[model samples]
Target: MTAEEETRTAAPAERLWDLAGRWHGVAVAAGILVLTRVVQILLLVGLDRAIPDPAGLRSNLLIWDGGWFQRVAAGYPQGYTYAQNGALEGNELAFFPLYPMLIRALSAIGFDPGSAALAVSWLASLGAAVALHLLGTSLFKSRRAGWALVGICCGAPMSVVLSMAYSESLFLALVAGMLVAAHRRVWWAAGLLGLGCALTRPTGAAAAVALAVAALVAIREHRDEKKWPPLVAAAVALAGVPAYLGWVGWRVGEVDAWFKIQTAGWGTSFDFGDSTIGFLSDTLTLADGWVPMSVALILLVALAAAGVALAGRPWLPLAVYGIVAMILVYGQAGYYHSKPRLLLPVLLTLLPAAAAAARARPRVAILAISAWAAFGLWYGAYLVAVWPYTI
Candidate 1:
């Protein structure tokens, strides 16, 4: 082709390239998250065929807590037995509202509960990745660091939950969105996202602590403004746990109905890590011959410790969120074996390691991320496929 023709042809491609370059941060993060979800979907598809469940493909992505969410989305149908005398002593109260509500909305439009929940989860995971890209890039001032953070988030062992009909994806999206907004000093937006986060998970109260910390930091740095918005954000976030607990209490006709549900129904409460320590002890002693379980638990604890040690290096809000989230997750007397999955919402816990990986030489970073991705790619499948543990 002539020079003129070549230039003309390249113009269209140039514009496309420019647009893509402008969106590189969000695109990269979303791409990685999507890629992970695709892998998970593929695994689930295979699992569906291998197992002869009537729901088939729909059931693969809606296991465990996903099942509970589906039940809630259906408005506690007549057969749902998690309720006791109008009080929830079962898994129903243990689950939050926002996720089920979203699924419910989609299901109303003719989609099945499981499929709707899975689709929403997939989209939310991508949204979470995009917001995380913004926060990571802004906090660390390095694109590599931002992408690394996304990688860590997507590659964590429990990241498999992101693809399932679970609240982690939606919760993370709102959380990361609020954090990004706070970093940008968009107080109103932060406050709004904080509200959604509040409704998404019980641990969402961490958003309040984090937002309050951010507000205080802003005050210290003389950058405070729109004071009401930050305060509102903090208030809403702080209210989430109590509000849910209060509702549970009212419904169950006991002030501590929620706590009772967690304890009697789910075997979860505040024992200050005693149960965790005991579980670790049992696993390490080979009483169950599940040495790998012990190893996984140890690594998770190490990750939390390492994350805290590294938290001091990140933005103050992130540090507060990570620290408080970890405390809330582990301080409670929840299922010890579910620690890794339960802690999935604490995305900041991966920031320090992610930053380290980003700063390393290119090949080293690739190796680090590749290893993480490898483990996460299969771990969820194994949990669902081979093991009969709580997913």
Candidate 2:
């Protein structure tokens, strides 16, 4: 082949590459989100049909913790809730304020609490998709990777929470947006987004620390530049989680009130993975329910995935955020079934798969992700529709 022949052959490929470069990544992320949601909803509807006494798909979306969030949207209690036996019980205080606050604001415009909550969650989920795309593109310098990240995250096992009346969507949007801003050295936006994240969920603390790490990295790399902004951004982000925790303590007139409420209400406390290990051991060895065993396997796979992501040497702040988030999820003693949902927003465990998919041929990657979504969407739908316990 001569040079002219090679140039002619390469021109079309070059044009295609240029077209892809001009395509809007956010739109791709949105498309992936829509596709995943459609698949998940279809799965939910099919599963709900097979189950006895189906409450319909909408009701299933609002079941379990949806009531708690709705009550919170109505109003928080003045103090802790207690049983007739005088034992403290879990109450609205255990939940963070940011998510319900948005719900309340939307409800004030005439929408019911449930609709408002769902609206906030769905809108936040869109923001999360866009932000996650930005984060992936920024980290890997590949739009394909960004789209892959969005697709994988939306289709992750138990990711149906992203569509439900839950704070996970809001928290994910804020955290990913913060990371994107930090990576771009937009300290103010990063700081504000980080603060939002910290207020949205307990794992926001991990995000806050991650933002601080980003700031520190920036400061170190540009020693002579204006340092105050990054310093201030780190300080603001670092303060957010503690500030909310302090407010909760003051509201309840006990420094440990939030921790107490969490433990009393949901048996949620940091036991350094003891409970998780025990559950995994029992479920795997004792041959418990399929759901329990599946959850155990998911946990193990997530841990392994995280290790693989770390071995790839991700951006330092992201690595820190992922590590801390995993620690919080695994170290806590809560509903074993809920671990997968909690792991959804961690983002770290999904990175390796996303990157691999991004590197594969387009057809191969699509086929692989479709196979994954088939199982993940069905798994999530089954938990909500067929399983008797909370996700």
* Tens-digit lDDT string for candidate 1 (1-391): 6798567535633443343234876688788888877776676566546754534545556777888898888764322235546754565776778899999999999988888998889889888887777767767666677778888778777788888888999998999888877776666777778878878887788887898888777666754233565677677667877887787777766787667666766778877777766777667676675635744564466566555656467777877887788777767876665777767767666766767876899789978897877777667665665455675
Q: Compose the digit string of candidate 2's lDDT tens values, residues 1-391.
A: 6798568545643543343344475678898998888888888899999977887988988888888899999888887899999999999998888999999999999999999988999999999998888777777778788788888889888889987888999999999889888877778888999889888899989998998898889889978557887878888888877887798899989999999999999999999999999999899899888899899999999999999999999999999999999999999999999999999989899899889988999999988988888889889998998998987
Would you give me the overall lDDT of model 1?
0.73
Stretches of candidate 2 off by over 4 Å are 1-23
TM-score of each: 0.86, 0.93
State the lDDT at 214 in candidate 2: 88
lDDT of 2: 0.87
What's model 2's TM-score? 0.93
- Cα RMSD for candidates in order: 7.9, 7.1
By TM-score, the best candidate is: 2
